[model samples]
Target: MSIKLPDSVPLHRGLIREFHDIRVSDVSSSFVSCQKEIYDTLMFFLESGIDYEDLCPLVKSNCDTYIQLLEQEEESQGFQTKFKTIKENYKEMTESCEVFDLDTMDRYAERDITAPQLSKLLKEANDGYIPKIKISITMVDRILRAFPYIWKDPKCILPDSLLGDGFNNDANEDEIEMAGGSIELTCPITTLIYEEPMISKKCQHTFDKSGLTEYLKNSDTNRYMEKDCAKDGCSKKISMDDFSPDTIMSLRCKIYQIKRNENNNNMKLEALDVL
Candidate 1:
């Protein structure tokens, strides 16, 4: 017997459509996951490529920006907080002390007063018989000291990692052998080949011994006075005794000079052969 099919029966098409939708959703999810994976991988490679030298300036810039912002914010806050107090105090002091004008009073108040004098004036003011001028001077001194410029240490050095590996890894064994197996050496002071290398005990900056000695002799007014280190950004006071001969560095310089002379001779011979 033949069975009649239902008129609404598109069950095959519906099943196909449902399957297609599920597949599309799965594919989209997988594509998004793959894109994220690719981004993460790229970021990892980028981050890995940044060596200490590359990162140092960026870190310094960020620190400087942070400090500037903090200082500005503090200054704005301090001015706003102190302005009213100062104005009120000035008015009261001027009313009590008719002898001094605002400018004169301000100049006198801001002068460097000893700690003992400040304490005595504050105590006398507290006892209620002292003149208002003394109280105003103490207040001015406190305000000036409170907002004094903070001094940051100027001495900074690059870490060994940032200075790079002393050896030229890119040069093959043959090139290193030709160069007498000595890494490139330069004086920190003159940025030239080191001659009679001497290292500073305080900063460890290498310089030509004679050059450094000459510089010290010229810069120092007296033998007893401490000399500022010749290295850039190093403010450490170095005496004549703070320098020592760097024997290994001196040996490296000698080897480098020998290699350079050999290279020069070879170049001259090659030029004669070409002629």
Candidate 2:
């Protein structure tokens, strides 16, 4: 007699139930507070069988609805004012010919301007030419509070193994020691232990740099879609400028691979001796 496997719909319903149970709070507060929760819930749904491309429209609709609700609120007025101020200030700073010369333009084109360099330029622009200005905590808080509403639609959500808590959470020292102090690091994309790891500047997610580069180069669909991080629910857009060689992770992976090989060899030798 043949046995039938259960359909995924039931499993999906179960996960949805779990999601609602965990995040029962109304979505009336700061978008940041609920952003991670929404992303997590959506990721669960995606894993349960939802298509990534199809989910984009649903996500956009929900986000738009939430944004409309937020816009109708009294608090959003203050947020708008602060956003305008920052926008004006940034515009003024950028428009100054003295501040943005050929060298600055070249660096901007190369995406080589680091945080300190930008800070220094801002300081220079503000010191003599413009009135001394300080960005208040209220403004910063308001921007962060509204960011989730503005940046709601993610291009794609990849597998959980790629960009979720699984990648960020490290094993405890005790666990590491118990596991012979050898970590098994896998690339979320390749599902293999790390080889030539690269960290994303946008999300800090690590992947095999060469593998990612090749994937990006070859994938016309992803390139057209403006490929972002493949981590479970991360929406951070990525490009060649976003990756950096993760030498530390590479070294750790090498050590772990070597240790695992040695252990396997020793196990085989012991079994041979017994035989």
Candidate 3:
């Protein structure tokens, strides 16, 4: 299942922008608020099953904007610099909220530590703070409840044994042989063709269907289509291979590998703009 969101929406981009807007445009010195927002956003993303690669661009942009703002705050005497302090408070909050079960603890001890009583005693040592014993345990419970999804694998196979090695069965022998070989092949594919989207001028053809078909037919290229063309309005059999390198069509190719709206049967797309 995949989530369907508009490519134009830039979901993460907007969220990050909102965070920045709050700092400069709204409340100026509330570090805790900012920290909470950040935490909430992180939690939202974590729960949404967004991969790190997709989230990185927005995060990188956010960090760049944040660092500049923080630097400015540091220079201003009146501005209360609270980013670090707030971040630490957030860390502390998350740490205190850790949850654990007695059964789970015992299981961990049996599997890894071998000294269950000693491990329990060590955990107990951090109990006697000024806020008292109960508060720590409460926080631990909160942490556990809030972060149950953490460290969960979105896709993984269960091991047969309690402890077993992961294996990849899909790897081929040539891959293994090449890895072991000392000889290096650095040259790129000599006859490599750029991913040039060919549009036909005639029949208002956007992709080179017939041209590719004809090229393949001639070359006996059974697997891959061999020809593509981009002529504005000509009916002639124009081949992409014949087109000048610089004249390659700039038609955009968007691949929607992830879709967010799988569950919402009622929801409908109002528009799917194609040029």
Per-candidate TM-scores read: 0.32, 0.32, 0.19
Off by over 4 Å in 2: 1-184, 218-225
Q: Rank the candidates by TM-score, best first.
A: 2, 1, 3
lDDT of 3 at 27: 38
Residue-level lDDT of model 3, residues 158-200, one tens digit each, is 2222111222323312222122332111111122222443433
User: For model 1, what is the alpha-carbon lDDT of residue 264?
Assistant: 78
Supply the TM-score for candidate 3.
0.19
State which candidate has the highest lDDT: 2
**lDDT tens digits, residue span 1-275, model 2:** 75332211111233435533432233335544554455455335434444434555765665455445444443444444444444445445434423334545545444454112333433554453322222222322332333233323211222222222323433322222112323346777787777788877667677887668765664655452337677656677877677887544554454344445556777899999999
Among these predictions, the greatest TM-score belongs to 2
lDDT of 3 at 176: 22
For all candidates, the clash counts are 0, 1, 16
RMSD of each: 31.3, 29.9, 26.9
Q: Go through the candidates in order and give each one's C-alpha lDDT.
A: 0.44, 0.47, 0.32
